[model samples]
Target: MNKSIETMWKQGFISEGELVVPKVNDLYNRKSQNLVDKLQHMFAVNIKAIVIGALLLLVVMSLIGAPWLGIYICILLAPLVLMARQELDKSYNLSKGQSSLEYLESFNAWLHDSITRYAIYYKFFYPLFYVGMVSQGLASDAGTRVMARLLKTYPTDYVFLDIPGYVWALITVLLLVVIKYSAALYRLDLNMIYGRQFKKLEELIKDMRALKPE
Candidate 1:
């Protein structure tokens, strides 16, 4: 551990306690960090997929006109959706790792603080970030459809229903479901870990009472 981190822990900057549970680490205690890292990777992959797929579809649609773009869009969308599912696996593996030492504390206090910290960084930040990505696709789809109508490739009054195109979008929705379910399962595991970490935290609190801040 970094000496600064140790000093902060000692000073109650990170938390007020002695973290006595070392190598016998809990998986739940370290999940949020791993989840953050995996999401970073997934976002990178999504960018590459979006750019490459959109560019390819745009070029093909310009040549063949609108109806064909739907097929082309589907082809491109497949990878984006499939890779997103793959992201869930990455998060799953990330959630399984061990930490060096976890600050043991009361379940109410620790769980509340940890969840609050993570909700700020993960739920708020990540959703805002990913929402921007979904918006990009929606914009691209709208732009393409509108252009197709302008070029006389699509009927002006025709209600657009790209069966294959939506398949790709549906896949993304499915991947999100998988990610959510995995997160829920991980949370269940975390509740169990909270019980153990809380016991360890009580022990550490007792230990702290026996030591001075020398």
Candidate 2:
């Protein structure tokens, strides 16, 4: 119908030649931009949180004579923060000047890959971070005080293991348990952090996929 054709054209849904679906493209582009903005904002907020947390940790470590643990936290998370920045840059770059369904597909793939890598890296390092923190603390004056109190309370002879030894055993068991369930735990954590935003992206991608260019 001529009327329908004219309406489609007016809506920027169809074109005469190679099908330049401007409406669809523009919609996707706006969504991509929104996602990029969210990522940038999230990155900024995460960096701030990391800095604040690091400072607090450093203060605590200093008070407890376990400065190395604070340093370890900074060292571990610094690279991750940088990686997030790089990923954000890549996302923005991918979204630039391109708003087709193909672009949406590529962005979807990129997001999935980036998130997978992030989860992998996070799971790998999370236990190490905890181990370093605990190890450093256990070697500090604070640890000695805690050990003394624990020994006084529990009195090693009961269990045939000293307080510190029992603590080490407990830490080892915890490490094993965490390592075993790290993947699932990381997934839950990621879902908590990015679930809503990721769902939006998925929905946009699905919508774009359904739009067939003529």
Candidate 3:
């Protein structure tokens, strides 16, 4: 044990004669690998989900006669899905023969960057998602007929300003609801994608940082 500690000290992973913060051992390495593997699994799941979601969205839009909108959404989401797969692949190709601390540090940096980029991408992408779905639904055959009837029936009832009263009122209300909840939706989406694994990685990183040699 003393010899291993001395060797680790010489390797710059610990301070001379100081206690290791996370107690460097096989257990530590295993835990790190487990956490990282879990994250990779999540990325894999997300890739599949994205593909499935794209297909479903395309089918829905095509049924509604808005195949173009569905195609557009797939195009927008493709990059995000690709990005995630790329990151996961990169993580799996981690450096061989690295010390546990070095491995964790490298993983930490990659995980941090990956999480930030994914969050940013989703924040921008989701609003577009919301808009595409809503607008496409409204442009569908049934939707158009409903709007036509509403306008025909209540031609003079202005909901607000120059907009028709009942129709515009409904539109205005839906729009406001979407706008009000956009931030919350983004948070929810991100949490669903990266929350648990992200927090685990964060806690591991924190523990590793605490153990860093002074």
TM-score of 2: 0.72
lDDT comparing candidate 1 with the true structure? 0.43
lDDT of 3 by residue, 42-68 (tens): 778878988999999999978967889
- Which regions of candidate 2 deviate over 4 angstroms? 1-29, 95-98, 152-164
Worst 10 residues of 3 by lDDT: 1-10
Which number leads on TM-score? 2
- Model 1 clash pairs are 104-201
**lDDT scores of the candidates, listed in order:** 0.43, 0.68, 0.69
Ranking by TM-score: 2, 3, 1
Model 2: per-residue Cα lDDT over 1-214, one tens digit each: 2242233324543223223475555555556556645755675677677777878988997787677777888888888878877886676566333334455576678878887888888777778877886776676678768878988877665433334568778988998887777777878977898788878878876776666553
- Assess every candidate by TM-score: 0.26, 0.72, 0.68
Error of 2 at 131 (Å): 1.2
User: Model 3 lDDT vs. the true structure?
Assistant: 0.69
